[model samples]
Target: MNRFDTDLIIAGGGLAGATLALALARVVPSLRVTVVETFPLSADALPEHYQPSYDARSTALAWGSRLIFEELGLWPRLSEHATPIRQIHVSDRGHFGATRLNAGDHGQEALGYVADNRWMGLCLMRELLETGVQWQAPAEVVDMTPETEGVRVALKRGTETWSLSAQCLVVADGGRSGLREALGFQTRNHSYGQNALIANVSTGESHRFTAFERFTDAGPMALLPHGTTTRAGHQSALVWTLTDEALDEVLALSDPQKCQRLQERFGWRLGRFTRIGECSHYPLKLTTVDEAVRPGVALVGNAAHALHPVAGQGFNLALRGLMTLVEQLRQAVEQGQSLGDLQVLGRYQRLHRQDWQQTVQFSDSLIRIFGDAPAPVAAARDAGLVGLDLLPGAKRWFARKAMGLGGRRAVISKPGVARREPAGHE
Candidate 1:
């Protein structure tokens, strides 16, 4: 085994891991940090079909996440491919629409933006160059053993094995975290028994920079606008949840058939949903670990909790968790990374309860409220939305929470991120 040394060793290079690396670079510049990513980087952009159709399952970035990206200077690169979500229309199926949210309510341009994950992934890699962090892709942590002094991780790359010892470790290795499991953390999972049907399409009429969330018997059918000027014409990404049985039927349809089927469900709302790219299916569920903290190691992101996509916050909270940990570690650097001991872990636990649990509970409640076909449940939820419109204070709180600004530390939205006109447009 080859011996390696670093102040911190982060396993997994997905959004959570990447965020942790960048946050550390910014907040604790002198700390030695290295990321071990399983997925190797590729030079090719994989020419995608973006004609009238593109299968882009985009993310609805909250103000907080946007702020994080901006502070890290990753926003400029990603802004080119992202579109702002101006207005949000929320209602139950058919004429009984209950509540709608306008950015004017919050004195903001839009609640968030929608951008493709793959595009953002590339932007992350581009931003890393300036972050000055070391990364090992196509790598894995085969074994990890912890001692009072620190933690040691055995990394594997093909046939080579390297042993890395660090004073602190971050576990962001996704829902099925080997380290978390081995360290005695157990997760409680709740499944919605529904899958999200995602795709991108052209709109007949302009989307007017509006995003929509329409709850139905099956689940929510959301439309997030991609208001990009370089990409002329109105475009929107779809996240349509379906019953397990309906999911099978939708997934079985051919690409062309899917576009038509989606148009039928949407009723020409976006100009007949003319085209589609690759249709992907993912089941919705919640995986939360009650014990996410231990000595020398603390889990972040999906490793700590994996939530449903109804609110598109699964990754957002992960980003927030990493950011919080970075801030805590950065400030307590005199105490060293591992010195973030149990007390520091307590801080992380507290923030997780406030920031992440909110989204998980909100999304879970939505899945339960909308997933049920029972008449009483539907009626009750409808009334809830109706009541929300009448309750301004409640709506304001809801908007603030959704924007990821409710946390005590403003975990995700740190107030420094300012809106800038995206390139290729203004």
Candidate 2:
């Protein structure tokens, strides 16, 4: 028998990595776990914490993921910062066709909830403290080499170099995953020729927990309800995907000027856009990694795929990726199979084969279908939304897919984190 350094070593302490740590800690109390993070973020959060010029913007939580968080005991804490999405309205630019999806339609209070990235991170961090994960904060994982026995990880914390070995390694460092690259995982990327402008805007009237997706010639514009925390009256977070030229205008503008441009685009539907909070921008790109696991390594989150935010699936996929791995790893352990074995990893790939493949294709085609500037294509886009609204089954399926739980479980669940409940429990 070969000796292992740690039970699990996770790189990247973002949501996926951190949440996985907590889940593993809960399921396998004796499993040794460690998280390495690169961010030099402050330990404390500012009051109201609304500010312009921030890195992470906001994210939507799918129902399936919410359940996982609820199980992990992170939802109640998150509810304080989340705004439930009671309704979602969709429309195209300069068209009369529109559709609205309500909680009543789905027989649920809301389809999902939206939270500012910072607040969500804070909530996860709280859970981490309780999870008992050994943290190596402000530490970047420089190298991860798989040995015959397990994997070795090299880290750099400021000017110091440290090493750690683990039986299995999880690479969740995101799209440009350094560890994945070092291991030679292949990735394909497609750019959207646009940049997304994200910020919080105060629209005077109450948004009533409604989310809106407005398709424009530039790209889709989304306003996710983020209940007012500032004097901005009624506030919502804005996501405007723009053409390079339009993005240039936005990037060059002063804060006040950018807010003015947004006010003109969104109109007074909510109210005049006023107070702005935390402006961030990113050029849109779509990417996918065929093999999520290599040798003794496994990948999750953006490290495996980066989706278009127009559909809000990046973090949703992150949750899905980690959940799938957790369940699989648990099962493998019980089955007496090595968690890092190719057989175990292959099962995960197979289980996610349909859902993940569909996700990438869905996001890719979704953007292309709606983003074309042609007049007829624009008409088709509106027609599609109007059609989905009128068709009960289509609308319901769409909601299910968007919620990240089409249910459809595989014949065999993946290995590595098989959790069994008490008798009469699921």
RMSD, one per candidate, in order:
4.9, 4.0
How does residue 8 of candidate 1 score in lDDT?
Answer: 82
lDDT of 1 at 72: 76
At residue 350, candidate 1 shows an lDDT of: 82
C-alpha lDDT of residue 9 in model 2:
85
lDDT of 2 by residue, 1-426 (tens): 436767788999888888888877766556688888898656564344544233346788876667777666788878776778877887776777787888777777777788777777777777777766888888988888778757888989889998888778888887778778877889888888888888777766888888888876667899888754322236677889998899888878887787788867766677766677667788889888888887678888888888888877778877866766776777767787667888877877777767777777777777788776578877877788889999999888778766666633222222343444311112
Candidate 1 lDDT tens digits, 207-287: 877777877755788888874734435677788888788988887988778877776666655576656666777777788
Leading candidate by lDDT? 2
C-alpha RMSD of candidate 1: 4.9
Full-model lDDT for every candidate:
0.72, 0.75
